[model samples]
Structures are given as structure tokens and as C-alpha cells.
Target: MADKSSSNAYWKANIRMIQLFLVIWFVVSFGFGIILRPMLSGIAVGGTDLGFWFAQQGSILVFLVLIFVYAWRMNRLDKEHGVEE
Candidate 1:
């Protein structure tokens, strides 16, 4: 219910937040899980190598955390933009 410019700004901010979250998710799930596996092979996590752990579990955990974080952030953004219900 704000002005047109305010509405545009809200959408822009929302898109930016989505983009950032996607990038982080990609890095965690792809970068750490696959691309950087070799570099992380030496480290141990929960009885497996760091890379394997990331590929199997860490990425999933990170994704779930990101989901919660995104929801929380979006709520704040909605309030800021006067779009909350």
C-alpha cells in the first residue's frame, strides 16, 4: 500500500535477498560438496572426511538453516516495506 517507487524498491530488495540466499545455498551444496571436496579431504567430520560429510549431510543442514534464515529475514523485510499482514 505504499507508493509506486516504494513498491519497486521492496521488490528489488526482495529479489536481491533471494539472489544472495541462492548463491549461498549453491556454494554450500555445490562448492563445498563437490568443487572444493579435494581441498577439504584432510579434515574429518562426524567420522567421515569433511568433503564427504558436506556432500552428504552438511549441505542439507545448511539448506535447512538457510530456509529458516530466509523466512526470518523476509518477515523483517515485509515489515520494513509495510507489506506484512
Candidate 2:
């Protein structure tokens, strides 16, 4: 029972982290890239609107950063939960 509760807590934390990252991904890739693009147009990047930059490259860069962040965070979480590999 003890082990089961610990495992459940670990999984819950893991899922919560994933959900947060996914929301950020969606906002960056879709919201900034399309829906909120017009609002961001006033901001320029490399002679173009910020939205264009996000649609073309910024989102990909953000995704890469998020991947690393997730890895680093999850590794720390694993260590905290005594499940590091």
C-alpha cells in the first residue's frame, strides 16, 4: 500500500508536468503562430512580424527548449522519487 501510494504520486506529478508543457506548446505553436498572431504583429523580428517568426522558427526553438526543460525537470523528479535511471 505504501509503495502504491508513492507510485501514484510520482505518476500524478509526471502527468501534471506533461500537461503544462503541452499547454505551453499549443499556445506557442498555435496561438502565437495563428490566432493571436495579429496582436503580435506590432512586434517585429528580422524585418518581419513576431508571428511569422514563431510560425517559421520560434515555435520549433521553443519546443526544443521545452524538451530539454522536461528532461531536466523529470530527471530531478525521478531523483526526488528515488526512481532515477
Give the best candidate by TM-score. Answer: 2
Tens-place lDDT digits, model 2, residues 1-85: 3477777889999999999999999999999999999999999899999999999999999999999999999999988887776
Candidate 1 lDDT score relative to the true structure: 0.89
lDDT value, residue 47 of candidate 2: 94
Specify the poorest-scoring 10-residue window by lDDT in model 2.
1-10
Look at candidate 1 and tell me the lDDT of residue 73: 93
The residue ranges of model 2 lying beyond 4 angstroms of the native Cα positions read none
